[model samples]
Target: MDSLYLLLPVSVLLVLALIGVFAWAVNAGQFDDLDREGWRVLEGGEEAPTATKAQQAGVPLDPGQL
Candidate 1:
């Protein structure tokens, strides 16, 4: 019973803190354009990774290249 007094307040405070953080994130544009980054990776741009470049160039790739 005594533990409930401490735990309940702590849990409530923790939930409130989490809600505050989420609200702040929404106001700060953190959630904006969430899909743009996902699309960017799928849509492969001009800049390629080293492994991809070596494959394109037909050069053997070392472990570092990967």
Candidate 2:
């Protein structure tokens, strides 16, 4: 059918566009820092749980206090 001719070219163009975008991203170092990005999702070792100012000063929690 005539619609097949139009759809074929459109699909090919879309695939080409996606490939071009992927190539551009690769050339721009968008995928270079894989390890750094991966580790960011894990718990960071540097940050430790600490008490707030009120807790540090031995303040009692009121029922309304956040």
Candidate 3:
């Protein structure tokens, strides 16, 4: 029963820390493009707008590369 007193506060602090990290990520735009990478992989190595990231990074994508 005494352990519960410590465990409850620790668990609550863990939950709050996780929530803070998630909030920081959201504010930092980490979740802004969740499906973008999935679509890029699904689109395959074939050339397409999948190179948008590379293009934005000023790196050119070859005609046959993802």
- Judging by TM-score against the true structure, name the best candidate: 1
lDDT of 3 by residue, 1-66 (tens): 999999999999999999999999999999999999999988788645554676889987787884
The alpha-carbon lDDT assigned to residue 8 of candidate 2 equals 98
Go through the candidates in order and give each one's C-alpha lDDT: 0.90, 0.92, 0.90
The better-scoring model by TM-score among 1 and 2 is: 1
Candidate 2 stretches with Cα past 4 Å from truth are 43-66
Local error of candidate 1 at residue 42 (angstroms): 0.9
Taking the tens digit of each residue's C-alpha lDDT, what string does model 2 give over 1-66?
999999999999999999999999999999988799668778567878899999999999998986
- Candidate 3: minimum summed lDDT over ten consecutive residues — where? 45-54
The sequence of per-residue lDDT tens digits that candidate 1 reaches over residues 10-51 is 999999999999999999999988999999889997866565
Give per-residue lDDT, candidate 1, residue 30. 97
Clash count, one per candidate: 0, 0, 0
**Could you tell me every candidate's TM-score relative to the true structure?**
0.68, 0.61, 0.61
Note each model's CA RMSD in angstroms. Answer: 4.4, 4.3, 9.8
Q: Give the runs in model 1 whose Cα sits over 4 Å from its true position.
A: 48-66
